[model samples]
Target: MAGVAGRLARRWSWSAFRSPVQVTCSQAFPLHVSGTAMMATQADFENAMSQVKLLKKDPGNEVKLKLYALYKQATEGPCNVPKPGVFDFVNKAKWDAWSGLGNVSKETARQNYVDLVSSLRSSESTSQVKPGAESQQGTYETLVVTSDDGITKIVLNRPAKKNAITTKMYHEIILALQAASKDDSALTVLTGNGDYYCSGNDLTNFTDIPPGGVEQKAKDSAVLLRDFVNCFIDFPKPLIAVVNGPAVGISVTLLGLFDIVYATDKATFHTPFTHLGQSPEGCSSYTFPKIMGSAKAAEMLIFGKKITAGEACAQGLVTQVFPDSTFQKEVWTRLKAFSKLPPNALKISKEIIRKNEKEKLHATNAEECQVLQSRWLSDECMNAVMGFLSKKAKL
Candidate 1:
């Protein structure tokens, strides 16, 4: 509730509520110049405004302030309103942002807004692509894998489904990891689109019984699962997990494989394997205990405990936790800087650190998948999954 209030407060001001001033762009910014060029620019500016609403991710506060300043300047001509008081931080920051524009003409501000929007859209497009520099496979349906600015980023793209990992997603992810390993990027980052980092395996994968029945389905799935996890274990470069929001099941279990995990205060980590009558995967059985110790790890993997970002950090799962409002800006800044380091140096260093555990992780992964194959064929696992899906359909 406090977080909700805080976010609302940041978005609005007491002064705005007390004395509202509304100005439409067309009314305030009357054209000084005549002709098709001015009319075209105006249309483009309005189009840019619409495009801003379509952006997939927040462009951060600094960019938002610039946009606010430009929008106000273009429409209202200048910041004629009285400066907000110091104590009214939200209003004050807004006032400062607008007032800092310093009497720029409305036409220039409109053009600038259009240009800024264009730049932002372009950057976003580049950030979401397949990893290999020369590869033709630059697009994906369930994932975005790009190598740029010294970092290879793998973004889970199923936002409407809370970034759930479908069978197709598992294959794409494995391919992305393989590409990232050979890419020139200094590091690799794993994250997600929209609210969730990942909600874990799509339960629908269980319902679709194949030609060979449940036993064959389990065996085939185990192979894919082993290959998927081995990609993480064998990754040569530094692997980072940016936990933007709540993560569950395999998503939370896999964090222990990452070299660094940065999370927002709003993010949560949970391994609810037991809830579905399943045991742990993603080498969490080995890595979780090593990071969080046996008892705490058991609380999560066995008993289905969910921990907040702070608790995850305290237990050595997450490297750091930042305020939810500042998380993306702060984490991306550090990641970009980290990516500037020598690529080979970072890769070799990560390889050296992972060398001792590589064999053990592979062994653990094999054992876990072998167990999961058997479990998947069990009536307990089948009943639990079916019940969950039944409840979901009702919801």
Candidate 2:
């Protein structure tokens, strides 16, 4: 009885002295005070107006509004939260885009997006080379090369910048892969000197790609990288990636084209395309989920999840994960084992495997090139590249 009386008293007081507050979607709210109804102050109206502005700008304002409505209904009597599909209309236009079924009218654009997504999902793992093989060493800018033992080792030498791949480094890699192809080496091992394998393409040259010329430049660059990957893939020997540090974007996806991969405990793998509003590259889509599972691939492609080396190994993306201290020795031992194999036999085996998938690989490469060219000029990619360049300039 006392509680009911208290509630009634408060209600009566509100009705007798408060003005009738009119709430609108805008910043301004009007209130009408009847005779003797002067209890409500200007502060009350201002506070309401501020809340209105917040609701208007909040990304989840609609959701909050629905929740509030549901709360009001429940307090008045009984009600359910608005159905989940209520907001589905807002995303209706983008439904196809998100589902990978983009419109046929925009087929080229859709294909570009699909290809980029695929590249993000691919895994580049190389076949393991046996231990005790001969090795050769080479260096270019921030890259250190160790070849011989039937394997050319290309290591990113920039530990200071986490071994990010620069334009010069990119060209050097093309040269190294070409050399490896001509050599009688049974396998090639690509890794990093210190910690990081290759963080990503250095943003320094991003601004060098001209605005209108971006598409052609992208096509040329993609062709160059594709040729490099093709050389490794078609070589008489296998190619392996020994990752010890963060492999982001292209670095993460390039491994998809390799035959086998070994990573240290400290290695991390991620594709940051979606985060940057850009797409993936390096033929990742076809290879990634095939090496890892489809679900895991989706997680990496969609959310750009950063995966630990152990997680990568468990997902079948990495051939093995070893302690950081023993990783180098173990990798050398494996490479030497490959070097002991008959070079001709290794070449024959590699040729046979590649012959089976040669057509498909070439076709995929062509398709990827087409899409990459289209996306190169996209606003999202352009803006991201520009922003990256600006940030790099500051650093």
Candidate 3:
């Protein structure tokens, strides 16, 4: 455990460094009004509303409040209704957000709303386009999403980084899952573009510290991680993982959430959360034990053990292993047949199977993320991350 004084000192030192672009309670209103000539039109407001409907992940309570306030102000001039009583926290908060907008004109409110949505969308497009990526017309930077013949395949596209997941990739995957959930496809598949299935969370995601400090970054990341995992827990369609090669960290841990996970004979599974001075996530703490038994789960999650394809199959983490020579051909052949099954039947059957554990899985996800949020700010995690980076630099 870290000394209390040291922790206190670090928090105090970091607290004053405010994120320049962040909007807080005191700075909420008067949101960066720009040229009135270019103010968003009524059509823009409607477009923004439609875009909000398509958002996959919840943008959090604060942002929701802002959106609600902007919409009410833009459409209805100002808040005229009586504010709810003090004990009615939910309504009271909404009233405060709207009433706080004061006498802002409808045009200005619309513009601000448009700007907010644009900013939100901008954040998700931060991933750099890597070389050799065969990006489709309407695909995510870190993933290639395609639906055909009843299967929606989401392939991790950054093979140059061994398919390591970045922050943007996490958000993109959530978006892809959301799209697949509503598509005509009977099932959704997750795989990788190149040799490795997924190397795990891109370590560089930890190195960039915004002015919000480690605490704020940890909190934001925890929220993203929670929503990312929740996508799998709630996915209605059959979710299959085509583990073409190795998988690690979150990629390996999340396999438990899939209905089926097929791997190449050369593929390996690993979770090195402990090595990074972090705790288990992706609901591995709960599902790992349930799927593979306590001792084996402890070995992989608690002790950071790496297991081979055959071993993972034996432990029940993977459904089956195929030869590298024909892994894709074999997996696709089986998946195509599975996908051809009645979509509604497959969906309902999955719901029935997952119903008993849905609540538990959600609870586990919340608890694990909460623990990780704390761990991400600790000195131990920071030091371990730095050590990992230093070695990578040498390489």
lDDT (C-alpha) at residue 325 in model 2: 89
* Global CA lDDT computed for model 3: 0.79
Where in model 2 is the C-alpha error above 4 Å? 1-139, 210-212, 388-395
lDDT leader: 3
lDDT of 1 by residue, 1-395 (tens): 56644764567543332211211122111111111122227787788877776667655555666677778887788888998886666566567777866675777667656656655675467557643332333556788777779888899999999999999898778767766776788989999999999999999999888676878888889878876886787677899999999999999988888999999999998888888989999999999999989999999999999999999999999999999999999999999999999888987788778766664676677678888888999999999999999999999
Candidate 3: give the clashing pairs: none
Q: Please, what are the lDDT tens digits per residue for candidate 2 over residues 155-192?
A: 77888888877777776776566556656667777888
Candidate 2, residue 272: Cα displacement in angstroms equals: 0.9
TM-score of each: 0.66, 0.61, 0.68
Error of 1 at 11 (Å): 69
Report the C-alpha lDDT of model 3 over 208-307, residue by residue, as the tens digit.
7878687888978987897688778878889999999989999998999999999999999999999999999989999999999999999999999999
Give the distance in Å from residue 48's predicted Cα in candidate 3 to where it truly belongs. Answer: 19
What's model 2's lDDT at 282?
Answer: 66
- The models' CA-based lDDT, in order, is 0.77, 0.56, 0.79
What value does the lDDT take at residue 321 in candidate 2? 89
Candidate 1 regions off by >4 Å?
Answer: 1-138
